[model samples]
Every structure is written in C-alpha cells, then in structure tokens.
Target: MRIIVYGSLRREQGNSHWMTNGQWLGDHVIDGYELYSLGHYPGVIKGMGKVYCEVYRIDATMLAELDALRSKGGEYKRELTSTPYGSAWLYVYQHSMAGRKRIVSGDWLQRDKES
Candidate 1:
C-alpha cells in the first residue's frame, strides 16, 4: 500500500523505520495533523503546518505496523487521502482537528539531503 506520512516518521531513522519499504514513491511535504484530547480527535488547528516524508508502497504487514506506530500519537486514525501521486493511507486528525483549515497538499520538512 502507498503510505502518506505527515510527521517525523518520514525521517530516515525515525522509530517507524520498520515500516519503510524498499522504495519511496516520492518526497512529499505534507501537513501536520495534530491530535488533541488524549488522542481522541483532531481538535482545532490549520492544516498549513508542514511536514516532510518519503511515500512508499508497503505490504499489509507494513500497514499494520504503521497502525501500531500511529498508536504512539494520541488521536490519529486512518483515513483515505488523495495526493498528487495517487491515493494514500493518511492518518486523519479525527476529533482533534475538527475545525481546522484544510490543505490540499501537505509539506515535506526533511531538510537532510540523505533522508
């Protein structure tokens, strides 16, 4: 599956490294979906804040592992996101970002060329 990461998990050495597949679909600068209320909802926040990540097509096992990684963040839930490249598995803001401004394309924040 093609995964769309919005946070530090995009880092080459982030804790979610276990979910990284053989190749990255592309480098994307997506928005940060902040979780609120002890990880229950998205709450209030604009979808403008940027985050960088390498998109990849992983397997079911990887998807499950990613779901586990998401548990670390309090209020994130899986949702479908349409990206420039294609459809992706995006972690929704849930009730945390209830009234935030929406963004079409998120930002990629990885500055390291190696990443």
Candidate 2:
C-alpha cells in the first residue's frame, strides 16, 4: 500500500520513524486541501489550497502502525486519494480547525521552521 504524509511523518520530521520501513516515493503537491498547524504536528482537511507532502510505499504492518498513530476513525480518517503513484491513503483531519493557525503555504516543514 501507499500513503501520502504531509506533517511530522515526512522525511526527517518528528514521528518520521514510523515510516522507517517504507520506501520514499518522492514529494508531491496535492490540490484542494488545506494544511494547518496543530502545535507540534500538522493536519489537513478539504479546502481550496494545495498541500505539500511526501509519498511512501508501505506494507500492512506499517499501515497498521500509521493508523494507530493517526488515531484512525477518530481524530483523522484515512481515505484513498489520487497521487503520482496511483491511489494512496491520506489522513484527513476530523476535528475542528477553529482557531488553529492555517499553514497558508501548505508546506509543513516551512511552517515548522517558522514556528
């Protein structure tokens, strides 16, 4: 399976260890989604801006680990979305974005550096 990660899970970012077993597919720009700063990490939700992320090919074990880390079915929902590597899973934030700082640039690493 393949997954697109935009936040701390990106290469060299915090929580990136979860992807140590996965193959880095390369960076990608996903349109129609907005990225936000959620303190130490970031989250994405359907919106008008584009989101910068990295794609990775992972196995079932890694998928399960990611699901747990993302609080699948709760804070975030894993949805299949189109990517350069065909369809891939993306974690959509389920919580409210009220008061959360929007990462207008859609790049988590850039936002992290500014914060």
Candidate 3:
C-alpha cells in the first residue's frame, strides 16, 4: 500500500525512523487540504489549500506499525486520498483545529524554519 507523509514522518524528521522500511516514491503536493501547526508536528484536514507530502510504498506490516504509531482513532484518522503519484492512505487530524495555528505555506519543514 502507499502512504502519504506530511509531518514528522517525513525524511530526517523525528518519527521518520518508523518509515525506514518503506520505498520512497518521491515528494508530492496534495491540494484541497490544509495543514496546521500542532507544535512538534502538523495536522492535516480537508480544506481549500495545498499540502506538501512525501509518498511511500509499504507492506501490510509497515502499515500496521504506522497505524499503531498514529493512533488511528484518536489523534488522527487514516483516509484514502489521491496524490500526484496515485491513491494512498494519509492521516487527517481527528479533533478540533480551533486554537491551532494554520501552516499557511502548507509545507511543514518550511513552517518549522520560520519558528
């Protein structure tokens, strides 16, 4: 299965170690979505903007591990979304975005540099 990673799961980020087994498919920009700052990481939700992400192809074992790390039903909800490369599962924020700062640039790494 393919997975789209936008925040800490991206290359060189804190949680990227978990994705080491997957094959890097390259970077992609997914539109019709918004990214918000959640301090150490970023959250994505359906909206009217773009999101920068990296695509990866992983096996069911890796998927299970990722789902566990993401806490599927709590912090984030996995959703099937279309990416430039193809269709893939991406995590969307589960709770509220009321007080979170929106990442206007849609690029988490760029947003981090601004801080």
The digit string of per-residue lDDT tens for model 3 on 41-113 reads: 8999999999999999999999999889887569988999887678999999988999999998999989956
- Candidate 2 wrongly placed segments (more than 4 Å): 112-115
Q: Return whichever of 1 and 2 wins on TM-score.
A: 2
What local distance difference test score does each model get? 0.53, 0.92, 0.92
Compute the lDDT for candidate 1: 0.53
lDDT of 2 by residue, 1-115 (tens): 8999999999888889988999998889999999999899999999999999999999999999888989855999999999989789999999999999999999998895655
Arrange candidates, best TM-score first. Answer: 2, 3, 1
RMSD to the true structure for each prediction, in A, is: 7.0, 1.5, 1.4
In lDDT terms, how accurate is model 2? 0.92
Give the per-residue lDDT digits (tens) of candidate 1, residues 9-104. 555444546654635678765554432222212222334455445577778888887788665655457776666678887775444344443332
Residue ranges of candidate 3 with Cα displaced over 4 Å:
113-115
**What residue runs in model 1 are displaced by over 4 Å at the alpha carbon?**
30-51, 72-74, 95-115
